[model samples]
Target: MTTDPPPEPTGAPAPTSTARGARLAFRRWRRTRPFWAALWTGTGGFVIFFLPMAPLGQILQVGVGGIAGMSGGVVLMAMALLILLLPGQRHTAGVIAVIAGVASFPLSNLGGLFVGMALSVLGGSMAFAWLPEKPARRRGGRGLLRRTRSAAETPVPPVSVGSGSP
Candidate 1:
């Protein structure tokens, strides 16, 4: 019998090799750990760290407050890295990240104008709540109903009907 090629998907154009590779690579990386949590946490940390030091068209001077804010941001970013690298320590990292985010408010320009604080808190929450998915169980056949042995192969004995008193 002559073999036929499988039909291509409709509506969407085929992805280029580089695009496909990148997508697959990202998917693989994301599946292995809490990628979003790490990214958000790092972003929040960056904002918290840099906002205080940034000069608003004037002589820039980072004082003790800036230092504190920078420290908090660094802690948050470290926590994010911890979560990404050591997923087992996610809970600890998450808690620390949240605390750092909250602490950054007074220290880092109102927690990077609240944006950084929000991102840090959100990222920490996600890390804390993240859970591994269970693998699906597979059977060797299709359809919902399972195959069973024939009734004749496992016959049931007949029961006689008797009408008298017990």
Candidate 2:
């Protein structure tokens, strides 16, 4: 008598390549918390520094303050961009940003003082909180999930010799 081969099993649908890539990208981005914080703060700094100009002109009747205000806002914006560019040096950059934000207040840009200080301080705090993650090692070498042994490594049960049978 001949036996047919076992039927193939089918169940879950496979994920598409695009879905897999997106998942990987998301994971990579999620791991870099400090980088995201820096980026957001930098963007907010730029917007806040420039957004007040029109309002200031309408309210205070100053198209633009003297060089001190302009330079301070420019410097704060520059520091924010610098932080975004150098995530590895986030702590140092963040501290500098916070200091610059404070200085911007006394320099005549109150808008920069509030928005820049709040965002930069938060970003700096995040940078301080971030910890470097270790690289994942291959399985079977003191890893969390060890690989199962191949068929070659499987032990064979010994057969009894010369057993009496009908």
- Overlapping backbone residue pairs in candidate 1 total 0
Tens digits of per-residue lDDT, candidate 1, 84-164, equal 999889899999999999988888889999999999999999899888666777766553343565566666799777956
lDDT of 2: 0.61
**Residue 44 deviation, candidate 2, in Å?**
3.7
Off by over 4 Å in 2: 1-23, 26-30, 55-67, 137-139, 142-166
- Angstrom error at residue 6, model 2: 35
lDDT (Cα, tens digit) per residue for candidate 2, span 36-105: 6665556545645665556544635654453455555566556556655556776776676666556556
Q: Which candidate wins on TM-score?
A: 1
Estimated TM-score per prediction? 0.68, 0.53
- What would the TM-score be for candidate 1 when compared with the true structure? 0.68
Candidate 1: residue 21 lDDT (0-100): 86
